[model samples]
Target chain A: MPGINTSSLPDIIFMLLFFFMVSTTMREVTVRVKQRMPEATEVQKLEKKSLVSFIYIGEPKNTKLFGTKSRIQLNDVFASVDDIPEFIAKEREARDEADRKFITTSLKVDGNTKMGIVTDVKQELRKSGAFKINYSTRKKVERRSR
Target chain B: MARRAAPEINAGSTADIAFLLLIFFLVTTTMDVDTGITRKLPPPVENPDEDVDVKERNVLKILVNSHDMLMVDGKRSDVRLLKDKTKDFMALHPDNPDYPEITTKFIEELGKEFPASKGVISLKNDRGTSYEMYIKVQNELARAFNEMKDERSVELFGVKYSQLVDENKIKAINKLVPVRISEAEPEDIGGK
Candidate 1:
C-alpha cells in the first residue's frame, strides 16, 4: 500500500520561490543614442547601480530650445541641465527601494555633436547630487564593405 | 491499524511550483554595468584652494555663459572656431603633416612647448547656462584629448591604429590629463 506523506514539500517549494523572488533583478530601461566612448583597454566593470539614466545628444527638429532637438519623446529626452537632478532623483528612489547604493547614468553624445553639450551634461549630473556617472561607448566594429 | 493515519495533505505540488518560479527569476535577472572616463577628483577643500594659480594657457578653460556664449582661453569664441583653434593649439609639427587627435596633440604640443606646464583641462561654466551644453563641452574636450593621444602614438611614435593597441596605455595617458570642472556660485554667475 502506497502512502502520501506531504509536509516538507510545501516548505521546500516556498523556500525556493522566496529565494528566486529576492534574487531576481529587473532589466534596466535604456535609451538609444550614439556615444563616442573613451578608449580604455582595461576598464573595470561596475556591478551595483542605484539608477541608470541616459542622455541623448542631438538637436530637436524645429525647436529653438537648446537641448530639445526632436519632437517625438519627452521621457527619453532631457532638454537642459536642470532636468538631470530630477531624473536622477527619481531613479534614485526606484533604486533605493531595492537597497541600492549610488545612482549611475550614461550620457550618449553623437560624434557630430558639440563638446559643450557633453560638458553641460557632466556638470549637471555632478551638481544633480549624483556623483557617479557612466558614459556609454560601443566597441569599434570592423565593417567590411561589400 | 484501521483507526490511524490522519488525512495526508500533499504540498509537494506547491513546492514544485515555487522551485520553478525561483529558477525562472534567476534566469531572467539583468545586471548593471557602469562605464566612463575615470579621473581622481581633487579632495574637497574647506577654505578652497585659493592659492592655486590655474594657468590659462596650458589649461584649456571652456566657459559657457548664461546666454549660450562659448569662451575658450578667456576669449569668447564660436564653437567651430574653438574646435579649430584647439586643433591648432594641439598641432605640434604643422609642417610634418597628418593631423592627429586634438587633445593628444594639444598635450604633446604643450609638453614640447611648455615643458613645466601640467597638461590639464579646467572646465568652468556660468550658473545660468543650460545643462545640455555643459556635457557637450566636456565630451568634446575628452574627445579632443583622446584624439590627440591616439594621433601622437601613430604619427610621432609610428604606432598605427592597426598596431597592437594596448587600451591600458591609452587609459594611462588619459589618467594624467585630469579634468577639473568648476561651477560659479549663484552670486558669482548672478543666478538665483
Candidate 2:
C-alpha cells in the first residue's frame, strides 16, 4: 500500500508561515511604560497603517530611564512634549507625498498617567498641524443598556 | 542491478520542518493593530479669549476631581450614567425653550437656534486626576453625540448616521448635535 504523499505538506505549511510573517507587524517599539488602557465604546480602526504614527506615554518600565514619572516615547526613543513638533515633522517627511495629507498621530497613553502630559501633547500636536489624533482605547460591553 | 535503487532524497523531515515553522508563527503571531477613539484637534487659535463667560445653563459641566471622582454639575455621578445624562443635555434639554423637543430637527429645518450647539460640554479635570478617569469621561461624551446623531439619522434617513455617505445628509444630521467637548484649561494640581 502506498503511503500518503507528504512532500506537498511542507509547501502548504510554509505558505501559511510566510503569510503570518508578512501580514503580522510585530510591535515595533517595546512599550517601556506600564499600560492599563482605558476602555470605551466608540472605537474606530485606523484606516491606513502607513499614514499613522504612534506616541506612547506612561511611567517607564525601568525606573532608571524614566524614574516614577510619566514619559513620552516617540519611536524607540523617550521624548518630551517639546520634542513632539520635531518628531511629527520628521514623521510627516518619512511618508509618501500623496499620503502625507492623511498622517495621523496615535496617542497610546497609560491610565495612570496624569492628564497634564496628555493635554501638553495635544497642544503640541495642534501647534504642529498634526491635527488628527487617536486616543487608543480598548472595547468592552458597557455597564448599562441605556 | 545498481539501477534497481534510484538516487532519492529523504523527504520525511520536510513535514517536521514545516510544522515547526507553522507552530512558531502560530505562537508568535499577535493582533497588534489597536482601534481607538479617533478625534481631530482643533487648530490652535491665534489669540484665544479666556475671559468669555459662557452661560451657566448653556454649559454642561463635567469635572473629574483629583481623587478620580466624577462630578456632573456638582452631583456625584457614575461614568456608566454619563452618556444618558449627556444626551439629555446636549441633544435636547426638556427645559431649554430653544429645544422644545429633544430634537435637532428645528436646527436642521428652520435654521433656528440649536440647543446642542448652545449647550457646551465643558470638561475640566484636575492635574492629579488619573488619565483613565479623564478618558472615560471623554468616551462617554463622545458616545452621547454619536448615539444622538445615529438616532436622528435613523429618524430622518432610516439609516445609521455614521453609515451615511452623503455629505448633505451628514451635515443635516449632525448640524446641531455635533460632538463638541470643550477641554477647559486643566485646573492646577495645587487646587485639588
Best by DockQ: 2
Error of 1 at A70 (Å): 19
Could you give candidate 2's per-residue lDDT for residues B68-165 as a string of tens digits? Answer: 98888889999889999888776555765643234333654535554434677888888788888888888888888889888978877899987999
Off by over 4 Å in 2: A143-146, B1-28, B49-55, B93-117, B162-172, B187-192
Candidate 1 stretches with Cα past 4 Å from truth are A1-25, A28-132, A135-146, B1-41, B90-119, B160-168, B175-187
lDDT of 1 by residue, A13-115 (tens): 7776777677666654344343344333323344454355556664453354434442111155545666766876776676656554444565555444544
Encode model 1's per-residue lDDT on B1-192: one tens digit a residue.
578878887655776777777778878865334454433323334464465664444456677777668987778887546545555555443333232222322344225422212434556666455544554565556556555556645654467433526675454344433333443322246451
Superposed by TM-score, candidate 1 places the C-alpha of residue A104 at a distance from the truth, in angstroms, of 5.4
lDDT of each: 0.52, 0.81
True contacts kept of each: 0.32, 0.78
